[model samples]
Target: MINKDSVESAYCFLHQKYRVYEFSNSETQRDDIEFAIASYVNDMNKELYAHLAKGRKEFLCNHTTFAADMQEAINELELRL
Candidate 1:
């Protein structure tokens, strides 16, 4: 039952944690930001999938979709930058 609001909130939290605004002025900086966010999301997906595979019932049933949504957000941010 993960909602859009929750996804957005998580993205905002990660956005702040990663200091994404620091890379707002140039192509290179934007690329760096995109790479950083992608890497972070990749790590998160790995850990989440691992837990899901281990039969962790608490893991979201739609985690792959959640990861995709996060990735789409990152791509949109990169485009805006």
Candidate 2:
């Protein structure tokens, strides 16, 4: 089974690293930070899918909906920016 705790921990670590940039009150800086976070999350998803077992991969594809939900959230956030 997939370890939710480990996944959450990894996500927290990544967020702490890339999502903690200081806001500089500049549109360009905000865009840069958003892009960086998006890139990091995309890379992380790629790595996760690569390492998952076949059954888990299938579970992600057919059972869980986090991928679509996350993409929708990202698109919404981008639109707001």
Candidate 3:
């Protein structure tokens, strides 16, 4: 469901407001970004949890696994970008 539009929206939002400097550092900003991502992931996992409650084992597994993998890939790509 994370199509190009969603990615662009997230990237643009972060770029315009939350994106950090390359050399200068800020722990609070880092923490804020971490919190934001954690919150987003928590919300996503709640839907996965609901699916699990409904006995959709395959989808639950696939969704969780794919999400984790996608996050890792995105993290790597973010560094590269």
Relative to the true structure, candidate 3 reaches a TM of: 0.34
- Ordered by lDDT, highest first, the candidates read 1, 2, 3
Per-residue C-alpha lDDT of model 3 across residues 1-81, encoded as one tens digit per residue: 434444444445334333342222776765555555545444443433343235444321343353343344354335434
TM-score of each: 0.34, 0.33, 0.34
Q: How far is each candidate from the true structure, as Cα RMSD in Å?
A: 10.5, 10.8, 9.4
Instruction: Report the Cα lDDT for residue 30, model 3.
Output: 52
Q: Quote the lDDT for 71 in model 1.
A: 49
For candidate 1, write residues 1-81 as lDDT tens digits: 434554454456555634543435666765555555545544454533343235543232233443344444545444433
Q: Give the residue spans of candidate 3 off by over 4 A.
A: 14-18, 21-24, 42-81
Write one digit per residue (lDDT tens) for candidate 2, span 1-81.
324554564355434433443335665764555555455445454444344322344322231443343344334333333
Task: State each model's CA lDDT, in order.
Answer: 0.46, 0.42, 0.42
